[model samples]
Target: MHGGTVRPRRGWGGVPKINVYLPDDLAEGVRAAGLPVSAICQRALEASVRRVAAIRRTALSAHEDPTAGLNQFTDRARTAIRTAAGRSRAAGGQLGTADLLHGVLDEGANLGVRVLRALGLDPAALAAALPQRPQDPVGAASFTATASAALELAVTEALALGHDFVGCEHLVLGLLAEPDGSAGALLRDRGADLRPARQAVVAALVGLTRAAPDPLHPVLARLDRLERHTGLAP
Candidate 1:
């Protein structure tokens, strides 16, 4: 029962015991340093378990629905729009491009957020730039003409990209394509140009399509470099 002899719990069933192998020199150094090997290993395992669970949650959220039609939008994209509509309704204003912008950021893991981060813009700051909506309007909130046009353009962007599902990236491009939209204006004011953002989205799609077996691999290594170049990432 000495302090150094304490070991982590073994499995309840027939599971095998886990072991760690270290280089002789490293093992000797650790022993000489009087490190608590079991405690260190336990902490490392706990951190790894948390990381894996987060990845699983993200993957589940991004999973494509099998029942969706060929031309139907991805669940994430649809969720973003629904979130936007809800925001508009709460504000007593019609759904507009600005609401859509907020929705994409709210969705969290979509390509639209990646594009904004790639371009060195804080999504939260961009969201804060949207104009305040009036309260207690007379009628139900609906999509504005510009917002409707943006949705149609999103479909067109998806088709052009040869993707079966419309996504947040397409929605972002659609916002930029719209001639008169507050969301697009806000993006431009934050230095998010259409051409570069479009290029980044295309590159990101390519990387995702060609990603290797490891889920944590840097699919956007080039984009990461670009972000670093722009002082977005360290």
Candidate 2:
């Protein structure tokens, strides 16, 4: 199935050229399927660039505080916030919780994305439900108050779950806690209730705890407590 060698396109405007490496079986399958491997690789690369840019944006936005502990946000969560910020900036709209939800889906691989997929919710569809705005006359993007509140709640969720790092799963909990946020409303309308989402989060964390034991000890303990409290423990 594999015949021609995959070539790299020349970089333009200071963009570096990248060589793609594919396994024999996968490369053969791509050739057999007549897929546009170069285009697919380009798109994936662009998405990765966007995600990295968003992470940088998120890190820069946070103020350095000596008194307060430094926030430990997973790459996935940072990317989600960055994606939300990018969407708001593009539309000249303030970043909101809904944008954050869209960002989580946009990131593709994360706890929130997995939970939503399990519920048969399409990330693209969730994104479509967000309000679209025309480009602003003077471009400026800021976080809405509600969005800020949700972020704080995300931190709180992480603490409650006994996690040292904030992640996309905590963001989902934040969305669910935000009473008036569009993200929560949209998810609820689509049958993603808070309880089920929490359950999924716990279950996933439990699996992770078993798969990788040391880093997740506190999280596993918290989950055990929660499960017992809810009478869901075996």
Candidate 3:
């Protein structure tokens, strides 16, 4: 009745809502952009919090905090991206988001890739979808190796669906896309419903509203940093 209350709404998840305030100019910006003010505010706040937490996570290795570990993941990932981009430039090719993703996947030191492997993804399968790297007359550097067709398709799906980056959820969707692929077969074998799973991820990505303080809310902010760090999005 006053500010937006967490009324049990009708939907797949019965999501909750929170009330907030915005300045006149901010409200105008939201209106001119044809956006939901509450959602925009929530997203910005979430992103900021995540960025701080992620940086902190990387700075302090001794702390066993979950936030610490998550930030470390991003830190390691950014480092790998920079290294791969250097390789690509050395070979004369411009680095791109796909290139960065390939770098992340190839970085044997990171636990993110390991987590994907544990979830039944065969890294080799991704290789099959890789696009031919740009070749300079002088043989510009090779940046990202080709991903599997399934992996490419997954990335394509995320882009087509208007997502800025291919996160873990997108990877899961990609795995599901490959029915005959290793990850797909594994998920299916385990009785995982790909459609529902995808929907759930989408819901989390879209409808799951959050306030500034939640731990997981920072995922978007961390993603923004990743985008800039990897040269994924300007």
Best by TM-score: 2
Give lDDT: candidate 1, residue 216: 28
What's every prediction's RMSD, in angstroms? 18.3, 18.8, 16.0
- What candidate 1 gets wrong by more than 4 Å, as runs, is 1-71, 132-139, 212-234
- What would the per-residue lDDT of candidate 1 be over residues 111-205, giving only the tens digit for each residue? 88888888888988887787665443333466787887777677666554445457898889888888799998888878888778877786767
Each candidate structure's TM-score, on Cα atoms with residue i matched to residue i, is 0.57, 0.63, 0.32
Best by lDDT: 2
Model 3 misplaced regions, further than 4 Å: 1-73, 132-234
If ranked by lDDT, best first, what sequence of candidates would result? 2, 1, 3
What is the Cα root-mean-square deviation between model 3 and the actual structure?
A: 16.0
lDDT of 3 by residue, 33-68 (tens): 797765655665565455434433332112222223
Using lDDT as the yardstick, the better of models 1 and 3 is 1
Clashes in candidate 1: how many? 0
Off by over 4 Å in 2: 1-70, 132-138, 214-218
Alpha carbon lDDT of residue 116, candidate 1? 87
User: Poorest 10 consecutive residues of model 1 by lDDT?
Assistant: 58-67
Model-by-model lDDT, in order?
Answer: 0.67, 0.71, 0.47
Instruction: Supply the global lDDT for candidate 3.
Output: 0.47
